[model samples]
Target: MALATSRFLPVLDCPDPRGLAAFYRDLLGWQVTQDSDDWVELSRDGYLALAFQLAPQFVPRAWPAEGVHSHIDVFVDDLDDAEREALRLGALRVDHPPTPQKFRVYRDPAGHHFCLCTT
Candidate 1:
């Protein structure tokens, strides 16, 4: 049994929702399904969505730090090309040691950590 049944919508908190949303919109090529001053939603299909919510005092979690909640993993075909695109979109590469061969980590403009994974 499940308490609720629905598709997952990942929401990221950032200082500027629109700016963050634009970053992801360009990265994923998703359409802006909804928009507001403090929130924005992007979707490729109605079944799944990604959203950004304004958090004026948001403090981003540090990579390689404990007690972190979650991070996004974007799978792609080419690691080098994906890394290039993410960097072009204002993502800063996280260069900690012991990086896995199949994935590379990066931080978005708002400072949230995400991975460019190959699988």
Candidate 2:
């Protein structure tokens, strides 16, 4: 018999799981389904949650060098409005004057790179 393995969640490393989780929770419009001092999960009604794990010795990835191991792309109708909201939520702009592709890159409070785009 095959073992049942049907769930997948991307876990990000951060010094403070609580704060990073809060950032993703707000960014994804998801609610926290689970919480702990060292771990957190943000989930939507029918989607797998994005999880965070505490890593006291975590180092920020070197973008455009080591590049991103993984990055999230959030599609939005109003790129400006979305970029504004991301900035308000502690995301710092990494790439300005987005390309014709209509995507803006940003680094979250914990320094994780993600994109606000129109796709």
Candidate 3:
């Protein structure tokens, strides 16, 4: 009984996809699954995919904004327990969030939104 069983991927719009993809590739040691001037995808087995899309008019959003909205998408067997543990560990739950399926949103200490999903 899960809301979504699809793989989670976070797509980010950037001025330079190749450059940002390179940065994340080196940072995470994830293999570059796809690469191009317009788009780049980096992924590691058992982890979410990181996608960078080139957008000439892309502008960075302020903190707490969704311009780079990304959820690390941690999967677990128990959503309730995981959400509770996340709250206990200092993650602030988002009230009346917007998203499809059964997922919970929370803001990290830095005010970035992420999702806790079960599949």
Candidate 4:
């Protein structure tokens, strides 16, 4: 018999699981698949799922810091349109406007760095 392989799911830990889950829910238009005091799962069409977990000791990542995860990249079809929409949706613009390469970076309400790149 063949060994079963499972797909990987990206899990994010933060102080406020509900807040983080809402951010992603709005940003990605995903619906809440599961919710609890300590965790929440967001999914769309059963293909993409993102999990947010509550971590009492959660320490936000310092992207440019010496030993922290840099950032998460999200590819979009229209960089300008997406940036404008993201700003309207409460994302703080961390970097300057989109460059010629068609990418812009921003920070979520909880300080996680993410980028919008033209795909």
Question: Which candidate leads the pack in TM-score?
Answer: 1
State which candidate, 1 or 2, has the greater TM-score.
1
lDDT of 1 by residue, 1-119 (tens): 87696677899999999999999999988889999999999998776699999999999876566535888899899988998899999999986537566898888999988888888
Off by over 4 Å in 1: 96-100
lDDT of 2 at 11: 91
- lDDT-better candidate, 1 vs 2: 1
**Sequence-dependent TM-score of model 3:** 0.49
lDDT of each residue in 2-117, candidate 4, tens digit only = 65857557888888889988988988899999999998999989878888888878666655554457566878888778888878777887676537467787887667778898
> Which has the higher lDDT value, candidate number 1 or candidate number 3?
1
What is the lDDT for 2 in model 4? 68
How well does each candidate superpose onto the true structure, as a TM-score? 0.91, 0.90, 0.49, 0.82
TM-score leaderboard ranking: 1, 2, 4, 3
Estimate the TM-score for candidate 2. Answer: 0.90
Per-candidate RMSD vs. true structure?
1.6, 2.1, 9.1, 2.8
Candidate 2 per-residue lDDT over residues 96-117, each given as its tens digit: 6538359988899998888888
Model 1, position 45, has a per-residue lDDT of 71
Q: Candidates ranked by lDDT, best first?
A: 1, 2, 4, 3
Count of residue pairs whose backbone atoms collide, per candidate: 0, 0, 0, 0
Per-residue lDDT of model 3, residues 48-113, tens digit only: 688988887865445454455454566666768877777766677765546524688766443445
Q: Which one is best on lDDT?
A: 1
Give the alpha-carbon lDDT of every model: 0.88, 0.86, 0.68, 0.80
Residue pairs in steric clash, candidate 4?
none
| Model 3, global lDDT | 0.68
In Å, residue 94's CA in model 4 sits off its true spot by 1.6
